[model samples]
Target: MRIYISADMEGVTGLVDRDDVQPGGRDYERGRRMMALDVNAAVRGAVAAGASDVLVNDAHGPMRNLLPEDLHPAARLIRGRPKQMGMLEGLVAAHDAMICVGYHARAGALGVLSHSFMGHEIEDMWLDGRPVGETGLAQATAAAIGVPVVALTGDDVACAEATDWDPSITAVAVKYATDRFAAELRPEDDARQAIEDAVSAALAAPLAVPEPAAGPAVLEVRWQSASVPATLAGLPGVTATDSRTVRAEGELPALYRQFGVWMRVATALTNQPPYC
Candidate 1:
């Protein structure tokens, strides 16, 4: 079986603040190492579960966080940005399953370093009228292409969010959130072990790939800046929901790609840092 792993930094084993995940932060180097370790654990699990191929995507900010030399030898890495699918880049129907590693919660959530695609720029998002976050969006996109999200690893809040999106996904919480930038972390070794074991068990079982939506999915985003929506409204099929929000309709993966365009537009118009 082929396994795809999307690795994000915020919810990695011991990260809790922007300083931990952002490039210039004092602990960013250490954080990236931690990120790689968490991903390696997932890679090891996928291999143990009979995966014939493994692809790991660096899905965090910059998309260059995971070092090629640090990744497990069993896995190939997709790093860097401008990817059409963003976090879900390199994911396709041919992959048997996808595993999300070190993902945080949605914007305004209490999980460590919680934020949506563009940090403060995106206030909230809805997929088919259900409040959605990174975890939900990724899961939905993968399902659209016939790939099952078999497991996820993150903080307690992120794990709960995953369960809310799809209970069948095995969620391994590496930390318990105390606040947005704070958490009661599990020891690194213990957390990695949990991630490894959970992923192995999840992949070892029967995987269920949800049927793709029959019709188009509606995507709505409430942005912190009205200019963002105003700018995104220019995109085909995108409409201004309000001064600060926009909505669009399209098929899965395609809709997912459109959202990436929205983010780029917002990034060009906003100057706020992700954690501000």
Candidate 2:
């Protein structure tokens, strides 16, 4: 089986703040190592369960959190910025299954470092008119490509959300979300075991994702600042909705293509220099 893994840093075991995932911070290096180790563990499980190929996507800040030398030798990595599909880039019809590793809930959720996409830059994001966090939105995009999201590892809230939206998928809930910056978390060994078990179960009885919302999808993002999408309108058809929400229309792929561009604009506007 070919597995596509989208690894995010926020939901890794022991992560609790932005400083952990940001470069040059006191804890970023240590946290990045942990993130890589977690991904390695999941790869171990997938390989043991008969997976022949695995592609890991470093889906975090700067998209360069994982060290190549430290990654599993059997795995291929999709690393870069401004990807065509962003979080779901390496995922395609060729992959047998997908594993969403180290993900968290939406911005306001009770999960460690939880946020939908751009965190504080984006207040909320929706797909086809329903509120969805990063996990849900990413999975929906994967669904469009005909690949099943076999396993997901994250905090309690993230797994819970996955349960309601995609119950057939395996879950490894490693932390109990206390708030965005804090969590009642399990030790690394325990979390690793949970992830391993979920991977095994997922491989044994891989479940198909529910049908994705068919074409002509609508995308909206409620930003922290209303001006975000106003700038996006300049990027083709992305338009502003009232003040907070930005609206766009198309099929899943087209809307996400447009959405990714808008997201870039928002990131540029919200980015702050070290002096700031």
Give the runs in model 2 whose Cα sits over 4 Å from its true position: 207-210, 272-276
Against the reference, the lDDT scores of all candidates come to 0.92, 0.81
Count of residue pairs whose backbone atoms collide, per candidate: 0, 0
Q: Per-residue lDDT tens digits of candidate 2, residues 132-225?
A: 8888777777777778787888888888888777877788888888877788879899899878777977887845554767667778888877
Clashing residue pairs in candidate 1 (N, C-alpha, C atoms within 3 angstroms): none
TM-score on alpha carbons, each prediction:
0.99, 0.94
Give candidates' CA RMSD values in order. 0.7, 2.2
* Candidate 1 lDDT (Cα, 0 to 1): 0.92
- On the 0 to 100 scale, the lDDT of residue 269 in model 1 is 91
